[model samples]
Target: MTSPDDSLQLTATELRMATFRLARRLRCARAADSMSDAQLAVLADLRMNGRRTISTLAERERVTAPSMTNTINGLEEQGYVTRAVDEDDRRRVQVEITDAGAELVVETIRRRDVLLADMLADLDFTEDELTTLREASVLMRRVTDR
Candidate 1:
């Protein structure tokens, strides 16, 4: 005897929680030398998009300029990223991921993929069930992107 609005609210809550748990599980499957999540996030972005300015990264990561700088500093200390003056504009500084950073990201991804693959395999889901899960993942991504 629940109203439609209440049912929708419950569904939304469930979806949010499910996604959060899954993300947390993946995050936990990192390498022993994995950097902080913030640092990793910045490195991952740089890896994907080449070099980026501090302001660009700050905006993209929804963080303050100082916060991004601190994150960048930590990454620099670990040799995961390097900052250099922009050749096109000496006034600007650009950050780029080093080879070590790229390797760490790849290794972390492999670990997470292995963890997920093993767990999913253990579940022994039927083909239809796996297909449904894949479709649901796509739908959830669409929901997020919107």
Candidate 2:
């Protein structure tokens, strides 16, 4: 029989792999004409965290400042985002999502949810299995919150 420590290690590996695969599958559900992944990430970040400086966004994304600048420029051209000089510091520019950007984020989520729901329906999971997943999801959220 496996020791408690061995069981914990196995459980951790399984959870990691499952979550990674789930994330990839969800990405596949994105709309074909939607913004690229990186652009969408930036938009989502802005929407969730409110407006922030270009430099701050770049740091969070772990990309070069110039690369982030280019991404922001494309988003701006498409009217998905707008940049404005910081009122407190004219030299600093802050980026914010537009109504179109927020709408895109919401729509993308809706599409992914529909896809996931259909996939889950096909699984025909038992009530016990569903309850276990729900509990695991709550645990996952607690882990992420830290």
By lDDT, the best candidate is: 2
On TM-score, the leading prediction is: 1
Candidate 1 residue-wise lDDT, 1-146, digit = tens: 99999999999999989888988988888764557787778888998999999999999889999999999998888888999999999999999999999998888889999999888999999999999999998998899766
* Clash pairs, model 1 backbone: none
Please, what is the whole-model Cα lDDT of each candidate in the order they appear? 0.89, 0.90
Candidate 2 at 67: error in angstroms?
2.8
Model 1, residue 29: C-alpha shift (Å)? 1.1
Worst 10 residues of 2 by lDDT: 27-36
Clashes of each: 0, 0
lDDT of 2 by residue, 33-82 (tens): 75788998899899999899989999999899999999999999999899
Clash pairs, model 2 backbone: none
